[model samples]
Target: MQIDVLIDVKTTLGEGPLWDVQEQRLYWIDSVDGRVFRATADGSEIRAWQVPQKIGSMALRKNGGAIVALARGVHFLDLNTGDVELINDPEPNLKNNRLNDGKVDASGRFLFGSMDTLEDGPNGALYRLDADLTVHKLQDGIVVSNGPCWSPDGKTFYFSDTWSGEIWAYDYDVEMGSISNRRVFAVLQGENFRSSDGSTVDEEGGLWNAQVYEGKLVRYAPDGTIDRAIPMPVKNVTSVMFGGENLDTLFVTSMARPPLSRFPTDSVQGGSVFKITGLGVRGLPEHRFAG
Candidate 1:
């Protein structure tokens, strides 16, 4: 499959890639730039919203609008009226931390995580936002919390602490809103320094995860074995989500960090969002936040 640059804009840290199946538009956030973007399927008619703070992620609400995450807290963003309602702040004490990757589950609950401000140390944690608007901290002792995704069956949950270079799977109880039997599902083996950034599952239960600094996308089977690898044009591949009309198109987002002395020349393609075509597998539709 050929990875095409759907959006040419450079971002300091472009992470989330959300597909609006209803409007056939692609949405994503630039973490460091404090911006969210919306664009047509063909990359035209793009619009941007300047968030007040660095946004980790966002989820579409069932009623319209979105559930937004930032360092301060999760807020119900009413785009229609330009209003932001505070859902809850999970980390009021951890001022050095900021919210990171997040997504709503199949049952309409939001799963989100936080990252340490310095980008190091085990100061991050993961939280789940229930349909009733209750916030629950699921796990602690994390660094750069990301890739909060669930299996197609909702029986397993996958997450990662980017600083650790390991993606973990949890035996999930979707109905109970709990996870257990945590274990490694995928590991990046190398001395060059790279870790799992973001992920999405295919219809066939394959986990497609981006290996940051490695410049590749790794697809792991349900058995936790390497299924395939696709090389990217940049060194900082951030996240990927399956979108498009048939859910067969894969939209990948990336980042271009400040002068990393080693990979100095790849900054051009690092921050652009890409679209991959010809993938035989389709993806599950995104779940909307119930609240």
Candidate 2:
């Protein structure tokens, strides 16, 4: 496999690499910078818009525009005008909590989780936004939420709490957009221990996770066993997604400024988005938010 910097733009906290199949473009966000970016698969014609608050994730809308999870709550973003209308604040009372990583399910519902701004307590929760624009809380007692994804058959859901050092799997109900039977899918331990930042599933059911602060892309088989681990050029790798014409190229996003004091700020290509080819694998097309 070969990897190289695709976009040289520097972002404070780059996360949420999203591949748009219909539009044949890639979307990503600078979490702490409140910036949303879009570009062709070749990393050209890049366009970025600044949100009013820090952004966690963004989903393409079936009709148009996008649904963005900002620091305050969920909002409908008009990319052309850079106007955002608040949908709802599921945690209006949680002063220290903010919405985080999220993804669209096969049924067109957007599922995302919250994280504590202080990263101190388990003050966060998981939520789902349906097609009717209604929000529902799915799970609670999370510290830092990240990596929301599903299996190929839509039966298994994967999520992680970054500070908890664990990635959990849930039995997902595709039709109802509900999750249950929460269990540990994998633990970050041993010599390779590192926090899970973001993830994407391959067509063959292998989950590729970016191990933040560890500079590695680790793939776990469907059974939660480590399939392989590929070292990254940057130490603060944030997220990954499969883009390109054949959906075989892996797009990676990173961070230039470390969030915590423990991580070094000076790292090679820290904020550059990367492209990986020769993986010999493809990813399923991302689902659009029905709302």
- Please tell me which predicted candidate would have the highest lDDT against the true structure: 2
Off by over 4 Å in 1: 258-265
User: For model 2, how does the per-residue alpha-carbon lDDT over 1-291 read when each residue is reduced to its tens digit?
Assistant: 999999988989999999998999999999999999999988899999999999999999999999999999999999789999999999989888899999999999999999998877999999999999999999999998999999999999999999888889999999999999999998875354468999999999999999988888899999999988998888789999998899999999999998768666647688999999999899989999999
Cα lDDT over the full model 1: 0.87
Predicted candidate 1 versus true structure: per-residue lDDT over 215-246, tens digit per residue = 88989999999998998888788899999889
Clashes of 1: 0
Candidate lDDT (C-alpha), each: 0.87, 0.92
Each prediction's Cα RMSD? 1.7, 1.2
Name the top TM-score candidate.
2
